[model samples]
Target: MTLQQRVNELVRACFAGIWIESHEHTDAIAELAGMCRDEQWRLVTWDIERGLRGPSGSPSEHDAGDPLAAVRAISSLADGETPAIVVLQNFHRFMQSAEIVQALAHAIHDGKQRRGFVVVLSPVVQLPVELEKLFVTVEHALPDRQQLLEVAAGIATEDDEMPEDAQLDAVLDAAAGLTRYEAEGAFSLSLVRDGVLAPSTIWELKTQAVQKSGLLSIHRGAETFDSLGGLDALKAFTRRAMMNRRSDGQAVRPRGVMLLSPPGCGKSEFCKCLGNEVGRPVLTLDVGSLMGSLVGQSEERTRQALQTVDAMAPCVLMIDEVEKAFAGSASGGVNDSGVSSRMMGTFLTWLNDHASDVFVVCTANDVQRLPPEFSRAERFDGVFFVDLPGREQKDAIWALYRQRYDIDLSETCPADDQWTGAEIKSCCRLAALLDVPLTQAATNVVPVAVTSAESIDRLRQWADGRCLSADTPGFFRKEVNSGKRRRRVTTKPSVN
Candidate 1:
């Protein structure tokens, strides 16, 4: 059901209190107020500073200008008639207090016969156990593509321009994941930056728009499918899965993908390429950045972040190096004071039940450190193991890096499968810096498969049959018994 219909029905059913969680409070509040106006219900708002505001027969605007008084005023309007809606702003701060709890409980039961309901609006959601059952919570989503397109069209009309509809659609796609206010600001900025109000200008302004949110950032990555050396199977799988164009029949859900591999194995690069391949804008989520200092702030940040992702439906959401973000928190609760547990719970729940069209691509290096519940099949569509690149894959990677930097790979290629794609790229970069051949660069580099042999073997052991291999068996062989090859020791020390 739509937010409007849901709110109307809930109000009709006499839902005592309705709590809304949203980042775009202004938009949500305006929408709900419009709905109330349509239903002809008297709308009132409250703050701690305000006593009681709205149409209570007296029709006095009680402390609307004062934050605290506004909450108090709205809270005091439980006995009013004429079908009233009391919107209490930031009242969650006092939800834990005994007085506020009792007041809200009494107001809920007392307003039953009378057409009155209290609405709590906040950027964060915090409910004491006493009011959890009493209040019905609804999420207020950020502006979606359709809404953003409307905003852009409105802006263009205001500016008196008759741009092509395709250009407008491209602009809307670029502005995805942003709220209404953010989209408007971005559109204005894009118009001014390009000096022509062209669709290309939207990219420049989009960078600025995403920077302000500290949530998911839209990436205009230059990397394409051609940049990737191997993993043809993985690439093909994602290409079909990420298609947003609906087929004749109901399109299958794009089950999320999990990339499991060691660091510097090009997992992150694959994610970015997937977005580019799918022809959709990519949003990168920095999980560590969401951690907050204040109480309940982390959950609030997560909620906002996920809401932003959902608002940009039919897009790819990449969470890089997620194992560190959700590492081993289920047992031994002494670390970080249970913050990890709560974060894990929030993330897992979202991953499991999220019905939005956002396709998640989570990359993790160490499976042992990850929570067991996260690896289950239901959480993600497929879990692919990104083992060390084999000889042929390494050759392709070497050729790719050489071409990228305009270097010759015929005589300078690293012949072995010891290095990962990232390591190979690093070697090529170092070779260019030193004005030397690629083999010389290879001589100075030791891959993780060499330096951390045991850990790499363990990772291989765990992924042997449990995960999909990035390379074929002809090039990269797994030992029959141990599931890993013996590490090669050399006399010369290698570069990082």
Candidate 2:
């Protein structure tokens, strides 16, 4: 339901205090006013600039922008039996004052009998401890595709200024997760520059919006599955999953995968490329950035960030190095007073229950640090383990990077045993950068397999028969060749 509908029900049921979380105050207030007008209820608004506004649209400066006075006057604004609503704009700013908190608490408690409703409208919810029990939060969601189309119609006056069917769908897709105000600005800007409502212009603005929030960073690069080699099973699985997804949600959608691989493997690269492959934007979420200094701030930031992720639906959400992100959750709140645990709980709940078309891609180098419940069934479509590249996969990876670095085809590669795709790319890049032979460049590069062999072996042993294979369809199996040497990689033409 919309914000107005939700608020309408709560007010009629005599919910004394309501909190509206919104970024666009003007639009929210307009909707509330319209609802109140239709219901024949008294509506009053207050802000720092405009102390008080009654149903008559006149400002009451008697309170002189004092929040305590404004809250106290809410009951007086109501008729004998008519429900009166006082929307204090940005009321979270004054929550720190003990006097304001007390006044709000008493006002909300007494409002139960007097039919007085106090609503706090702000971008964030920061309820003081005393008033927390009395208030219920209602989020003002961003516009959906249909509403966004109406917005595009308002901006694109000329028929030529609007795009055709498929192009219009792209435009609506780009406008998702944006507020009505932001959508208008983006649509107008797109018309001015491209002469039509285009997705590219709106995408650029959306990227800026994501960056400004400091929650997630969006990647809309040209990289696709063609850029890398190996992980045939993974690539095919994701592509098929995308194809099978029904936009109407009639069928079970792809829940995404948990990628467990050693460092320098292609886990992160595969996630970045999946976006371009499926025509979705990849949103990289850094959990460390969600931490806050104040109490309950981290959890709130986590929820807000995930909400933003959900709003930008039909997209990929990648959480890199996730094992370290929620490490504190594993220790049962022994670290940092359970902040990390709470944050992880919020994320886990969202992961298991969110209905958005978000294909989550979480990469982990160490599975030991992750909570066991995280990898449980239904949370992810599958847990796929990416091991070191085999002979054929290595050949394909080497060929792609060699072409990228402009290396000669006849040149032979140095002995490469247990090398990851990233290591091979690094060797090729170093060979081009140093103007040396591939063999000589290989001398300067040390593979993670050699550096962390013990840990990598243990990880492989644990994943054997437990996780799905990225290169094959069945469960992953260890080669069991500890007594023998791995095959040395040489310059060979790849079949793929």
Candidate 3:
């Protein structure tokens, strides 16, 4: 619902205390003013700088620049027949004052009888214990597509500056989560930088915004599915899922996929590539950075990060090495005083329930360390096991990397049995860096299959018949090699 409709109903119902969380105060106040004018209700606005201004366009006697006085003055505007609204601008800053808190509590109780409402408008809602139950918090939503298009059109007035319908739609998509002011700024900046408006400038501003937040980072790269080889099954599944459209022509969003594999298996690279393949921005969420030093801060940061993810819809959220992120969640409050557990719970709930068009890709080298509930159905579309590249896949990876590093295809490639895509790339990089033969460069590279042999075996065993194969359809199975035929060889060895 729009802010006007919500405030209209609440004031009519005599809800005395209303808290509006909004980043764009000018737009919110303008909306409230229009609503009040239409409903024939008296509207008064207050702020520390401007004091209290009544509907008559004059400062009231109670305009003392004091929040306590502002609360006490609400009763004077109360009337049984007509509703009155008092808007407190940035009043959360004064919530720490005892006098202001007590006065607000009493005014809210008395305003119910007189049909008066107190609306607190701030960027954030910080309610004191006394007024918590009395106030109803409402979020001022970001601009929708229509609003963003209007904003773009308003800024791009010139004939050549305005984008066509298709380009305009793209621009709107880029401006999805931006506030009204931010959208205006982005559109204006885009026009100033480029002769016409484009998504590039908006995305640049968005990346800077995410970086400033410190909770989420935006991945902007040219990497596409063609850059990586293998994982055809995984790529096809995600593409089909992301491309599926509803009757309304909106794409059906896939929940996500849980990728389990050993190190250097292309899990992270695939995630980054998938975003570009699907035409969505990839958001890299670092769970470790979400951890805060203060109590309850970690949980708050988790919520904020999820909110940001939801805001930036039609994007991919990549949580790399998720097992380490939630390492201590299974233990019951033993380590880190339950911070990890609470943060994990918050993330799990969001992952399961979020309706945003975000495709989540969580890569984990060790699924055994993750909670079992995390892999349950509905949390993700499927749990995929990415094993070492097979012969064909390895050859394809080598061909790509050899071209990338200017290695001669005629030069016999080193033996790459059980080598992963990452290992192949590393070998190519080392060969180029040292100006040595591929075989000589192989000495500097150690494949994870050999370094973590026991762990890899255990992972393959656990994933057998349990997870989907990233390379082919159906459940993954570890190929068991029966002992080579040794009937005649054993006798020959004994004779020798």
lDDT of 3 by residue, 36-69 (tens): 8888888898988888887655896666577887
Off by over 4 Å in 3: 55-58, 79-81, 245-251, 293-296, 334-338, 484-496
Arranged by lDDT, best first: 2, 3, 1
lDDT (CA) for every model shown? Answer: 0.73, 0.89, 0.86
Best by TM-score: 2
Per-residue lDDT of 107-145 in model 1, one digit per residue for the tens?
Answer: 777666666687888877788878888889987766776
- Report the alpha-carbon TM-score of model 2 versus the true structure: 0.95
The residue-by-residue lDDT of candidate 2 on 1-496, one tens digit each, is 9988999999988999999999999889999999999999888899987799876669864464778889878767765498989999999999999998998888888899889999999999999889889999999988888889898888999969988888888898888888899899999999889999989999999899888988899999899998878898889988998767577766677889999999988999999899999999999998999999999999999998998888889899999999999999999878699999999999999999999999999999989898899999999998998999888999999999999999998999999988899889999999999999999999988999989999998898888777888887777877664456643222222357
Which residue pairs does candidate 3 place in steric collision?
Answer: none
lDDT: worst 10-residue window of model 3: 485-494
> Which residue segments of model 1 deviate by more than 4 Å?
46-80, 92-109, 128-133, 158-166, 191-199, 244-250, 330-338, 408-411, 414-417, 473-496
- Answer with 1 or 2, whichever has the higher lDDT: 2
